[model samples]
Target: MARAYNFAPGPAALPESVLKQAQADMLEWGDAGASIVEMSHRGPEFMAVATRAEADLRTLLAVPDEYAVLFLQGGATTQQALIALNFAAPGDTVDYVVSGHWGRTALRQLTPAVAVNVAASGEADGFRTIPARETWRLTPGAAYVHITANETIHGVEFRPAWGAPAPDTGDVPLFADFSSSIASEPIDISRYGLIYAGAQKNLGPVGLSVVVVRRDLLERAGQPRADIFNYASHLANDSMLNTPPTWNWYLAGLVFRWMLDQGGTSEFDRRSDEKAGLLYAAIDGSGGFYRNDVAHEVRSRMNVPFFLTDPALDADFLAGAREAGLIGLKGHRVLGGMRASIYNAMPVEGVRALVAYMQDFQQRRG
Candidate 1:
């Protein structure tokens, strides 16, 4: 079968060109006479891959010289625990703004380790809206403020429509999980103290993650931890504390290069807006045939979760979508609906195809 438009939340769709290059390199990478996965992390060939990946990522995100970038194994969930260990003392209070499922998960990762003050939460309203900024009760001397930049499952985000793309937290530094939305637009990296994303979504394949942190935060006297869990140690050893996921790193490097060639974040910002607008318009105009419960202003551009008016038709909808060259439209288990995750790799044509299919489905079934 031909390649279908993929919309899985993570381990999500990658650019076709990146996949083709990786396929060719899988047998032998450059003149190394070995597959990238078989090469030593300490070897010059893989070392170059690691170096170029980080450098290209820094350039892609416009990371400041004052910050350090680490390409680590695992996903954003691992970083959740490590961030607390690296940035907060044992008794320190940490402020968290819970907007969606991932935001709640972030709180669980740091419990008992730190004093967590949920500054704001939208759970009371079923996570359909973000609490107004003024209503947040922030801690005065908290360790840091944390927020999920975009919620992949709940279909909510800290969008410009809600207020600032990045919220203001006064003196406390801001930390964000941008797992699903990173590189979809131009971000003011200076405004954030730390930003993390699992590569599977927007960056590349699975088994790798990217963390951008302000250098000064690394010096904090955090709680006792092993050298492997220390962000500073990971940085000191150049993110090669142990055997790194070289294949994922190499694949991500190819993706970064593809993004640069496609005109970087500014261009993606435009494409994201175009694709999301098209999809949302179709949902809103469905005249109750389709519904997305998320508040309009805070709707996620990356993940669009909506429901068919009749729950019984859910299975049929997905089956038809797959038959029409559309896949990954099934919603997360927690939500029990449909979600379209249109990340950077998804073209506007894909969204267009999805919208057309939806219209046809409604005509046939509605």
Candidate 2:
């Protein structure tokens, strides 16, 4: 059978060209005559791969010289702990803008380690919109302000225009968990003190977290941090503190190159917005047949979550979708609805296929 349209949120779809290149290079990368998985992290072959991947990403994102991009083993959940550990001393107030599920998770990870001030929260709004920054109750001299750039589970995104630190947040540095949104669009990296993303979403396979920290923040991490868990340690060693995730790293490099070849981040921004509009229109056009409650201004261009008007048709919808070559549309268990995560690699055609499937399902079942 032909490849299906896959919308799994992470370990998400990758560019076909990148996968093809990996297939050809799997056994013999360059002249090394060894699979990237078999190569030494310290060896020259993988070093070149590591170097180029970071370079391409830097170029694609326009990451400044003042920042250090470290690819480490822990996913964003680990970075949640690392960010709090590295930034705040015990009992220091840390401000968090809770917008959705992941935002709450990041806040919880910091609770036992720091005095967390809920700067802003949208839970009362059902995770449908971001609380306006002006409304935030920021503590003076808070260690840092953290926000989730995109809430994958809730289908809400803190868009570029809304990504700045709260006005009263003062000189407190800003950090973002861009796990699902990184590389989906261009960003003003200068506004953020640090940014992190798990590679599985838009970058590549899992097992790697891309941590881009402003060089100055490296000094703030408290001592007594294990070398392996230390961002500074990873920065100093160029992310080779121990054996890295070799194959995933190499595959990510290919993905970065693919983005550059496809006209960099701006092009991606246009395509992402375009694809999301297509799917959202389908939901809206269905009248009461389907629904997505996320506010229009902050709806995620990367993940689209919707519910069938008749919940009874949920299983039948997914089953029919799979037969029609549309997969991974099941909603997160917490949300109890259907979600479509159209990451950077999901082509316009795949989204069109999904929209068509939705229209057909509604015609049959509505």
Candidate 3:
């Protein structure tokens, strides 16, 4: 019973070392007599845990002094409406460039409540490409411009580093959904007014979303933000305004430490490129046997989605993958193809193993 290479997106793979640490310390955490799961979020033990987790994350991302990192309870989806509430007033508009599924989800959730302006949309291209920056129709007097830094479902990514000097955001703040791309590489956090990422993807586990917001934006929150959904409140209370997701918070801390031990985000960036490069090279070299729909320029280095020439072989392909100790090759139901989510936790060995299995699968069933 060896471990299988997992390719599932988001509640995806975690570093094995982190899991083992959790396992070894499950029954007793330090001198606390109680496990992390059993500790009070308000107590010194868990508070120190929370504080270190935040500090380590700040170091890992090189977050600026002006930004407050709030470890929140809900996933990124919750941030959509909350962001709208916190940033855009009733009559003021919120602009978005809807590149994929989660971007559209944000659009839908923010509409009606706040005026929604789609600055650009890739839906016309079937979400296979990112709409170029020059073509965007930015709204005047908009609260902020939002972009999904990486579209996990569509395999499209706009690396924050790739778009420095700010991409003509036009005096408004730039807010990015970094859920799938967070910590995958070095980013200029100072360019963004806010960033929200679900911990499940590249961070650690589910149940907590890390939000980094500039101090000024917290001060300028749109009127009538509910207490729980308010950024200012969360920062004021130190993200423990109420009971936070204690265990998930603890596990995320383990992951942050692991990232530091592995040489921070730059190392992860290299590993991600190496891993995803192997997969995409395999797909591109298959001589039309395997094809990916994404445009070359904006193709995701994190989520690699490909389709086989003969759709009829998809099931056999997946079954073969599983037998070869590869798992979660099934594509999203809406997309109907294969997606290999090679996040920070997925090793070079896993991607290489996948490429090897893919070569065998293609030969047998091509």
Candidate 4:
């Protein structure tokens, strides 16, 4: 069967060329006579792969020298708890800007460790928009201010505005959960003290999460810890404290290389905007047949969720989309609509196809 244009949220889609290269090199990676997955994480061959992957990512994102990039596991969910464990002590307060389901989940993880002040929330608007920065009430002396840059389920993104003062936390650091938006745009690394994401969305497969933290934050973590959840330990050991996910790391390296060939993060930002524009245009031009709920300024460029005016047509629309070679158009159960996740691997052509299909579907159903 031919490859389908996949739009699943995470573990979503990868470049076909990368997949082909992996298949070709599965038996022996460069005369090593062993699959990359079979190699020891401490060995030299695998070390080279790990180093190159980190280097490529650093260059791609322009990560600064002050930041320590650690490839850890447990996905972004673990980081939700780990952030509280590492940064906020008992009785310390932290600020969380609630945008959507993921933000709520992240805050839920920290409830046992600290007082989480919801600085701002769009829940009153049904998670369709972001609260303006001016509306946030940040607590002074808080440990950190946390925000999910892009909420995958709600299709809302908080774009960093230039020339603005950082959020008021009174010596607190800024942390971002960039699981759905990493690599989709050029971010100001200096503005954030810590940034983490699960690699499944835009980087690699599951089982690996990337953590970018400033060196100063490591000092604040205090004492030596033995558990895998300890960020300081992972940083001290160069993210190989234990047996790492060798296969996922190898695949992530291929993705890094692919992104470089495709012109790095700036190019990615441009293409992402273009793809999103194409899809949003389809929804906007559909008259009353289709609608997107996200506020214009905060709409996600990676995940585009929309709904047919008639909710009863949801199943038929998804089935038709699949038959037309567009897979994973079904929205999350919580959202109960159609979501088209056009991540990094989704080509502009795929978006064009989806838009054309949307037009056809609208005309037929009208």
Considering every candidate listed, which one attains the maximal TM-score? Answer: 1
- Badly placed stretches (over 4 Å) of model 3 are 160-166
Please list the residue runs of candidate 1 whose C-alpha ends up more than 4 Å from where it truly belongs after superposition: 161-164
Best by lDDT: 1
Candidate 1: give the clashing pairs: none
Per-residue lDDT for 199-264 in model 1, tens only?
999999999999999999999988889999999999999999988888889999999999999999
True-structure lDDT of candidate 3: 0.89
RMSD of 1: 1.0
lDDT of each: 0.93, 0.88, 0.89, 0.87
Q: All candidates' TM-scores?
A: 0.98, 0.97, 0.97, 0.96
Tens digits of per-residue lDDT for model 2, 1-366? 788999999878888899899999988877777788898998888888899999999999899999999999979999998887887877788888998999999876764757888889999989999988779988888888898989999998877556422233458888899999998888888888889999999999999889999999899855356777788888889898888898999999999999999998899999998999999999988888999999998899999999999899999999999999999889999898899999989999999999888998888888
Error of 2 at 331 (Å): 0.2
Candidate 1 achieves a global lDDT of 0.93
Model 4: ten consecutive residues of lowest lDDT: 160-169
Q: Write the per-residue lDDT of candidate 3 for residues 254-287, one digit (tens) a residue.
A: 9999999999999988898788788889999999
| lDDT, model 3, position 309 | 94
Model 3, 212: alpha-carbon shift in Å? 0.4
All models, RMSD in angstroms: 1.0, 1.5, 1.4, 1.8
Evaluation by lDDT, superior candidate among 2 and 3: 3
Please give the clash total of every predicted structure, in order.
Answer: 0, 0, 0, 0
State model 4's lDDT.
Answer: 0.87
| CA deviation > 4 Å runs, candidate 4 | 160-170, 222-226
